[model samples]
Structures are given as structure tokens and as C-alpha cells.
Target: MSDNRTWRARLIATSAPAAVIWIRVYVGVVFLTEGILKFTRPDTLGAGRFDKAGIPAPGFFAPVDGVFEIVCGALILAGLVTRLAVVPMIVDMVGALLITKLPIVWGDAPLFARESGFGDFLHEARLDFAQLCGSVFLLLVGAGSWSVDARLTATARSAASH
Candidate 1:
């Protein structure tokens, strides 16, 4: 009983404003779409692009990243374990900035991410930066009032009181 309460206590600890659902929705859709596009448009977004970026083992890593994005995006959309779900996405974005955007900023542009100047880097990196920030926000907040986490926490609290 005591152990269960401890677990429930941790679960019940999260509280967030409903506004965060907006961030979750945006982040989730973007990630999910990017993942699906990796499969549907492989030449542009998946292994081919990775190859152009000189990523090692492009075929293996791209698909793995796609699957990771899909699963994590779905979890974020459903507001389930959002804090945990966003961790992979955070890693994903950081890797993206390093692999794709940083090269552009350094003027050694990848095949697809070629840019004329630092301005191009800023423009191209905007989306990646936004998604990275959104993932961080979700990680900090742990979903919001309109989430599975909230419902589950509420349920846990009720059950505990009984």
C-alpha cells in the first residue's frame, strides 16, 4: 500500500495549464508528419537525405529515426508519458541541427540543405529549432490539463483516496 502511494504520488504531482496542449498538438503533428514522410518520400527526407549529409549508415539510422519519431509523436499527441516521449525528440532535434543545419551555417552545405549564407541557415533551422523548443517545453511541463496523463493522475488520486 505504501509503495503504491509513493508511485501514485509521483504520478499525481504534475499540473499544467491547458495552453500547453497547443504546443503538444503542434509538435506532435509536425513530428508525425515528418516521420511518415520519411517513408513516403525517402529520396528527399529519409536515407537519401541522410546520405547527402554524410551520415554513417544512412539506411539503418534514417528508418530508426523515422520509427522513433512516429512512436514518440503519437505519445505526445495522446499526452501519454509526454515528458518521457519528448526526450527522444529532443535528441532527434539536436542531432538534426548538428547534422543538417550546422553544416549550412558553416557553409559546407549538405546536398539538400545547401544555403547561400548564414541567413539561409537561420531560415532553414527555424522549424527544427521550434520543434526542439516545443519538445523541451513538453518535457518540462509533462503534458497538460487536457491529457491522458492528467486523466490517469486523477484516476490514481481517486483510487488512492478510496
Candidate 2:
């Protein structure tokens, strides 16, 4: 029994770093895809949606948000400056939840779902909340042992020890 527990622990330790990488990749892909879609389908998830949501300066903020998402997502995917990259994504998700999704939950139906019920509101906001939580996790935990940050830290340590 003890031997089985030891093996399980070893397996978990070995796989943990890979799990972080997977999380990074998953979140990065989501941000990247949404960013690209913002530009490619501007009338849907871009300025149009912003305008409908009553977000001020939708025309300017839409592209700006897209650029931030693309750049930050790319950085996170590369595991370079991932902590820094996720900051903006965290802020973005918070803004989305507050400015857009929360209102749906609170009774103000979104433009796309004015007829949707409270259950629909929860369903629609689920992804936003998940992304928010995921970004927070990445921000707190960083890129992990398999990342470029790990390599950089190792290099710095090696150099300092010399």
C-alpha cells in the first residue's frame, strides 16, 4: 500500500508541470481565438457588441482590446513573461464579467439575448467566469517548471552561483 502511494506521488509530481503547461495553452488558445474573431467578425464580438453593451468608446476600445488579447495570449503561449501577460487578461475578464455578463445575471438582458431567462444568463456567463478564474490561477502560479520563465530562472541561478 505504501509503495503504491509512493508511485502515485511520483507520477503526480512528474505530471504536474505538464498540467500547468496545458492550462496555459488552453487559456492562450481561447484568448487568441477570441481576439482573432473580434477582428475577423467585427460586427459580432467587436465594436458592435461593445456598442450594444453601452461600453464607452467602443470603436477605439474594441481593437485595443483585441490587440491586448492577441499579444498577451501569444506571450502566455510562449511561456515568456506569462505572469505579466496574464495581468491584462485578468483585467479583461473582470471587465467582461462586470460590464457585460453580470448585468445579464442581474436582470438586464444582453443585446444578443434580451429574451433569455436567468438560467441562460448563468450559462452564458459561465465561460467568462471560468476564464477569469483561470487567468487568476495563471497569474498566481506563473508558467511553472516547463516554461521559459523556468529556464530563465535557472540560467540566472546558474550565473549567480558562478
Whole-model lDDT per candidate: 0.86, 0.77
RMSD for each of the candidates: 2.3, 8.3
Q: Could you estimate the TM-score for every candidate? A: 0.91, 0.84
In lDDT terms, which candidate is top? 1
lDDT of 1 by residue, 43-85 (tens): 9899999998899999999999999999999999999888888
The CA lDDT at 29 in model 2 is 88
lDDT of 2 by residue, 15-124 (tens): 12646898888888889889988899888899998898899998999999999999988888877777778889999998987788777765785674563556866787
Check candidate 1 and list the clashing pairs. none
Q: Which window of ten consecutive residues has the lowest lDDT sum in model 2? A: 7-16
Evaluated against the true structure, the overall lDDT of model 2 is: 0.77
